[model samples]
Target: MRTSACVLALSLAAAGPAIAQDHVHAQGAHGGLGTVVFPNSGKTAAQADFIRGVAHLHSFGYRDAAIAFRAAEKADPGFALAYWMEALTHRHPLWGQEDLPAARLALSPLGASSQARVARAKTPRERAWGGAIEALFAEGKEVDRARAFADSMRRIADSDPADLEASAFAALGLLGLGAQVGKGITADDAIRYAENVFAKNPKHPGAAHYLIHAFDNPVRAEQGLPFAREYAKIAPDAEHALHMPSHIFLQIGAWEDVVASNERAWAASRAWAKQNNLDNAVLDYHSLTWLQYAYLQQGRFRDARALIDTARTLMASGPANARYSLWDFWFQYASASGDWKSVSVADPLSVDEAPDAGAAFPLPDMVQAGVAAVSRGDSARAARILSLLKARRATAVPGSYSNNGYEMGVALIAGGIARLRGDQLGAIAFYSAGADIEAKGSPAGPPIIPPVLLPYGNLLIANRMHSEAVRAFERELLLRKNHSASLLGLARAHRAQGNPAAAMQAYRQLLENWKRADADYPPLREVKAGASSSPGIILN
Candidate 1:
């Protein structure tokens, strides 16, 4: 199964690799691929594919970009810029992943060195751009290479001030350097460069797409909405463009927008995969995952569940990461719907028992699955899960995502184990320690399971800590607005604390959030019946 842009770049790509034949797939499958004004000296025959390739590259449509760039190379064999973009197809900046060997291989057909490749270019700007792309694949600490790349990009943008493409690429270089918009330095610089390009060329896919990645945070997601909205329409041929808007929608709790965007993206990906005779890896499972999560947020429980089987089937032959996404669908449904019966192939509760059982960030969903076992008096299973978490923690690189996740998981599950053993204070200590970690938000960005806050809140309620439970639920809601579980917990805790008005307000908001929810959803039934915490069972 081909991995990377599930969909092809242009309609002519329908013919696959021989896209250079008379029906060269260059001007986007749809003519609305967006306006890019790059005046490179490559032959006119190569420009269409080169422009399309640059657009796809901006959208992170790495595979399609590779196809288009290769088409450009075929059209004009000495188009060194074509080779430069093709090399970039192997380096996914936003994902923090790269294939240096593949990038070097892409450049090999052009020349043995960066200088040799630049010598093939017809103009100074083209030569300068060549140097920047060379630095992009250079050997050094990733941070240092990123800085070098950005520095060269800065020089190019400055020299060819009229080239919006260079400015957009410069903005991307800043992002690759971890620059945050408005945070100043390279940070302030990225926003200015991208925004400048965007203001001039609103239809430029690269400018819009880079701006979205630049401003995707809770504080500034609103700033990305304009670009996010325009990007997909500008490049409907690219699945990543359709899916990229959700990063903003998610930040702003725009669940309906997220649902709509990913629905289109996943469908496009599915169609492409089917046409290409590829399995799960060709499908946009990431968009599918986001679509399912959006369904859950909207209380469309049945719809969300329907997607899990589809996810598992489509991603069946995919790699561990893809299979983990299937597991995510399973875990999200199970967590949101409160279904604690059994495990599927994604087995949250079932231990791998393999010696190499981890890429390790002891999934919080797995932790809660163990807690569910404890709820059923399965101490042995809980202990096994805890032991696995501890081992995962031991293996984690300090301050990495895995390290943070495992550290967080250990605390929450240890709290559960402590509670199971009737060590109430010990349980509180563990949960409290985990709370401290969550507050830091140190690993950066968001988590798949959101650090298991609602369960912790539920645990507090089970222990009769009404005030703390209320605080926990509020904190969770702050992290993600209108979270149904957090709303339910908040409602319960408020009632327990003798704040009927506050409880009622929360219940009303929850009901509004669930206006279209599955009628018989367990939480819906509970809230309808004015059901509060049982003082014994944690509604985790």
Candidate 2:
């Protein structure tokens, strides 16, 4: 039994001077895979560069990986793996995104079939690699192709245990499978594969990076924190690497860490864009979105508002799709801060404002609009928003990505509308429906925009359903511990129900949690006031 570590060392030793020369030239930009040799890549400087590209690909640096692969092709036009890797770069396995046109163009120079591509390979291992990629691009449903591709990679890895790249790619395929099935087993497989690679090489970019994606939700988020903390250090230059840790941080509610990670990532993306002469650096948008969310969570309202304005300015000149994320950030910030006034600003847009407005507007925005309307005593506006949501829901495809949380959104909005109409029973019914849909949606993670449970619990408290409100707030806390809004609600519900002990406990917890929060943040001020008024809640 050849251990992965032994094989890795032997593989690096086999590459000899070419690997060192490639490392010296590439200067560790290939994500720390300078030593791992692809034996079939012809032991040349060009092949070494191709392996560097593979390392970048494993770390999710698709743009940089494509550039490196292209450079390899320029150095050696006959390198079949270079072309194959370039095509792979176009497919984001976890994001359900594929640039098929670009992939087809990349593969055009090579023959059509796997057998044809294999015939051009200079080594048996290279033939196997080409065949596996061909299986991924085979004609079928996207999920089916992904499953077939994962199977091929697993077989290849099993046959050649030294092929850490094959194992890493297989882990990515497992993530795709996990995403398709919406189950944890495939994600678990991905974690196991990544851990195996880590056991051999701790600094392996794919091992650390894929581990973050594998456990990005609430239940498993802490499991990835060790990797998350190390990933930025492992590949500091890769924008995705710097931004990836924030996924875990967000899941864990580490607002400060989230802010720091995205700040660095945003700056790096801007620098890279300037150096490369790319005007519209759309890549920075992702980090900016995360950064704004973090700033809002920290009660840095002024900072968050400034970031939103900056995002708006960027979108004016950026890609059209940038509007979707920028709008999401804006909506999330306003909702989190209880800024209902902002929500009322867009109540009059017709459904036909854009061809894809239905998908773009979705349930969360409608729910927020409806909530704002009801809060302002504008029942007519709330009703209008509800009607639009119902119409959108009626036309939505059941299992499509666009409609993943559609039912939950409808239920929450309908619930809010019922509460406004003084129908407590109807409100609870709809709110319960929303909670059920959310629970069934999959592994519980950070609260979605306009959090279903927080508002649902608030409605329950308003209706004097104290016990039910306590349960609702407790449920939200399980997903997001120490959440200020939920904690305040929990404290009030307990107080209303005459449980001073529990109320005091919750009030004390909220004060401690928000002590470092902005002094002027309404929630922090409210918590401080509550602590002062409560008999047994002493502020330390």
Candidate 3:
């Protein structure tokens, strides 16, 4: 139950020098991971810097890469490749965000169209790269553009088997394509592409980093561990590289590792912000949110509270995006700790206070407010919030999956209120609607914490609907195994249904899963104590 700052200090003291030395060794001896060369760009000091920028780009260090690319441009004003990369840094293809205006400005001097840009290229390969990126910015749907870009990069890589840089970029483009359409490049495909580059350059940052991203899900989390373990060592200065390992750790419920990884990443982000003379840093908020989540999971309430304060202070200085992180961290901490009082005291999102256009949808905050009202027996307040949520859903843009998801969250809150009012059938109907929405799957990434289905199932169990409760818990477990609450609920539901053996089995699994968790964690302590009293149950 260490504070995040203390954990970071200890982690850096124990591992920092070794990681820095590894990076030094890789780049020092024999010019390790030889310079990436574009066939058309004449070899110069500026081009060397450009190549370094490309390496950073591959590792997803867009800001740093952008800086380096700008420096390259300063060194050689006519370096079209440098300008191209500088523009590329503005777009996050996988995340579906693009600063199109910035990109267009960067490419302004080059040409107006893809063909025009290609025509300006001094060499065929340069033209190919220019044309590939042009496809990304072309007038089309993002998914279509991503597919075309991936195809173009693939052709570039196939044309020159010796250009490991091309191959690495092609792999990233494929990932972008997959992310756009939600499926295409499998983990195996990612591994294959990454390993191909690793065979030629073992210390390649992108190869290590993307390999982790490729397998950053529950089923394949362990497979990414090797890359996750090595990426920070390969690129210690990149904030994203330091943070990426936690994606795997979180999936496997390695709370301490998750805490340590994000702590280091948060420090890196702060240092970067200070060095750049920026008033705020986005990555700081990102890492802090993850760090607080780990602290909450380990039952370090005091530490988690400190993090909440820190996040609030950061939000005051940071950009609009930081508000999103602040709200997410606030909601997750309150929900996980079951501190409805805090949720009740929380301010609702006013239109003026909305972080962005997307965040103007107030269903998330209303959902929490409604839940807190129900918990506090303020049925009128809960009903008011539910009405507001329903009206919002009604006016939400049709066919928008995000809006539909919000409506589902609305259903959940309405159901909770119904349950509080003792209307069992109404509660079940609302809960069923919410569950149906979840069944359609999330359009975005997994949430920072477990889904609300656990509580919905617990409500069902309260009404003696044990079988339905068990199914709900099991469904949540499918999305995130080793979720402590879901496991405990499943166990209790089995017990309520007169299945002693199944209950005991679940209790044992919970015990095993939480063996390494903080001893003070309430769920872990509850399971341990409960198991001791269960007939024929044994604790290892």
Each candidate's clash count:
0, 0, 0
Ranked by lDDT, the better of candidates 1 and 3 is: 1
Q: Which prediction has more favorable TM-score, 1 or 3?
A: 1
lDDT of 2 by residue, 211-277 (tens): 9998887678899999999888777767888888988888777777888999999998888777777
By TM-score, the best candidate is 2
| lDDT (10s digit) by residue, model 3, range 305-357 | 77877777776675756235556766677766776565322455433232233
Tens-place lDDT per residue, model 1, 298-388, is 7998899899888766556565452356667776677677664554644544575653463343466666566556655677777778787
TM-score of 2: 0.86
**Which portions of model 1 miss their true places by more than 4 Å?**
1-26, 179-188, 317-325, 346-402, 442-446, 528-540
In order, the Cα lDDT scores of the candidates are 0.73, 0.70, 0.67
Model 2 stretches astray by more than 4 angstroms: 1-38, 322-325, 342-349, 352-404, 442-449, 529-540
Model 2 poorest 10 in a row by lDDT: 1-10
Q: For each candidate, what TM-score against the reference?
A: 0.84, 0.86, 0.81
